[model samples]
Target: MKSFEYLRPETLDEALAALSDPDAASLGGGTNLLDLMKLGVAGPERIVDLARLPGLDRIETLPDGMTRVGALVRNSDLAADPGFAAAFPMVAEALLSGASAQLRNAATVGGNLMQATRCAYFQDPFAACNRRAAGSGCDALGGANRGHAVLGWSPACIAVHPSDFCVPLAALGAEAEIAGPSGTRLVPLAEFHLLPGEEPHRATALEPGEIVLALRLPAAAAGFAGNARYLKLRERTSYAFAVVSAAAALRIEDGTVAAARLALGGVAARPWRCSEAEEALAGKPATAESFAAAASIALSNAAPSGANGYKIVLAERLLARTMAAAAAGTPAEMPALPGSLMDDTGEAAHA
Candidate 1:
């Protein structure tokens, strides 16, 4: 591992001060940072550990019926939290479908939100990746890119976002609480993550020294009574990355879909919300036909790679299955696909 300085600050101000340095980086749970460091992908001169920062680990229900989830909240804890499971089952279910229990214990909410993409070109050192080196041509354009992206992709990058949590967060309309030199601010979860249009290296909107403080959900999102489901299609049943996954929360009133929130993962550079699909389902009866139509609307403009040409069909089927299960209050069987391993090590470093 590369040598670096470490500072464990007990206060947010100290942590921000350390992170303000050009050579310094912030550490939340170390799940992503440490992995990148070991892979020679991230070499920072200093690290500002936010573990000791106070008021960043509290999970409380606001008086307005919104939930304030601390940045330091463990993924396992958040998944198993009674309040989260009840009020936002989609969030809890999404967390449960990610890495195993042991890894979840070590992962934090903030780190998960800040986690990078899983593109092989971005992780492998020998590959020429535009995301790794701004001017380098993206090798994935002609390389093994079955799991890259199908939506919101530019010539600069086709890397797929890998956070399972964000899929649900996007569908649930969650907001973020951030702190920086400018003081505390709130960012909509949908807008928090940026797509790789021209700058593939710039992943998020977090400015320098800005740290995630908490995740806040809107009060209107609660009480959706209908079934909420998270469908993950991977190469394996456990410990695998999603090839195409869908998180859906459907609210059926009098046998008709009153509202729905659908978000897709492993298909775009960022968590993708299917507003067209949502619009198609609104005010319509929840049925196999409607679900298929919605899924079709969602994948209408999907652009897949050479090898991943099947992803479009797979995504549609998975989405259809998710909506069908949500309508029936049953869980869909996870589909078996190739090369969907939990190991994201093949991705290249800065090209």
Candidate 2:
């Protein structure tokens, strides 16, 4: 790892000031940043540690009936918070479905949001990657890219954002609370991540000196609590990144869908929210037919960027199954394996 100056700021102002340096990078829990540093994928001249900053680690309910989650709140803590888990069960499930318990214990909400894509090309310093170095060619385009993006990809970059937490958050319409040199502002979680249109290097909406302070979920998001699910399909049963994942939530009234929220992960540069599918679900019966139709609509615009055409079919089926599971109602208790498919006896199926 490259040597760098470390600055532990006791206040947000100090942290923002330290980040004004063009070569400075913010450190949250260092779960992802540390690994990237070791791989030489990231080498910052200065590290502005936000660990000492106050008031960025609390979880509170706002007066406007929204739940505010501190950016520094640990992933494990957020998933384990009874109030948060009860209010946003799908979000909790997504958190649990992420990395191992030890990593989750150290991973903060902000770190997870800012985590880089798990593209092999982007991680290899010697490889050509537009995301890693703009104007440089993309080797993943002609290389091993079976796991690359199937939606919202361009010739410049075909990497997907690998965040399970952000899928459900995008579905629930969460908002990011950002603090910067220009002051504070709120940005919708769906728009926080930028697509790789041409500037693949600019991955997020954050400015040079901006930092995400927290994430807020409106109270209406809680209405789908009883009927929400996050399902993920990975190459392995554990400690693996998702090949495809879906977060589905529906508010059903008298066997009809009153409202719906759906988002897909591991298929795009951002958590792909299916607004059209959600609209199609409204006023429709909470049945397999309705879910299948919605799922089709969700993947209507999806096209494989490389040899990953299978992902489109897989994603469509997964979304339909996920919506069906949501309509079946959320499990009373979180599954032994949070995002895994369960058998008839309510046990997680090894398959």
Candidate 3:
């Protein structure tokens, strides 16, 4: 095991100051970060613990009906909150679909949003992973890639961001508030994540030493909460990472679609907001045919990898079915793919 200095900060300023060191990293629930450290994929010189920091645990309501979610709020607590569920059931569904009840209790929203990818190559220090070391080749390119991304992936890196909460958050047009060494700033939640473009190592748009304060859910989106659903397709039926997931929120009036918001997970480096699909569903009848058409259009631009071409069609199926269910204001639907695709626990079977 490696050794390092640990600093437990009591204030946000102290936390920010500790992060000014080039090799310092923030410690939240430590569920993901600690695992990476133990695997030798990450070894920070110093760990700045923000567990005692005040103001990051509140789930307060703003005057405009928009909710302010503190970065440190526990996943289980937020998911079980009736008021929070009433306001954003889709987001709650996304949260509940993550890791496990035990992990969720320890995981913070901010920590989850910053989780490293579960790509096997990225997790294996011996493998050539672009995300682990830029300029190093990405082994997943032609290696075992059954669960790799199909969209927004570059030749440099095919790894995807592994946050379930962020998919619906992007569709709802949420905003992330951050505090840094200089001052506070806001970034659109949808754009906060980065694509695996030129710099595959840079995962998020957050500059060094910038800490997330809270996430703001827009007040105007309250109406869409009633008919929203999150569907995750994993190898297992339980806590495994998504093979393909869809977050669908439909606003139907009379017999026609008034508005629609669809975002995809497990398909790209960031949560993929389907603007074209939303536009296609906007005045169409709330039916499966309409959903399928829009879903196909959403995946039209995807370039699937050699071993993952099936994901292009799989994504379309998940998105289309999810949209039809959302339009009917149905309850959450669990993904039921063939059992052979995943092992007994429900994660993808490594070929």
How many pairs collide in each candidate, listed in order? 6, 0, 2
Compared with the true structure, the alpha-carbon lDDT of candidate 3 equals 0.83
Better of 1 and 2 by TM-score: 2
Q: What is the RMSD, in Å, between candidate 3 and the native fold over all Cα? A: 4.8
Candidate 3 lDDT, tens digit per residue, 234-255?
8778778888888888889987
> Per-prediction TM-score, please?
0.92, 0.98, 0.93
Candidate 3's displacement at residue 273, Å, is: 0.8
The deviation in Å at residue 306 for candidate 2 is 0.8
- Lowest-scoring 10 consecutive residues by lDDT in candidate 3? 342-351
Better of 2 and 3 by lDDT: 2
* Tens digit of per-residue lDDT, candidate 1, span 245-271: 887788888989999988888898778
lDDT of 1 at 155: 83
**Model 1 stretches astray by more than 4 angstroms:** 330-351
List residue ranges in candidate 2 displaced over 4 A: 342-351
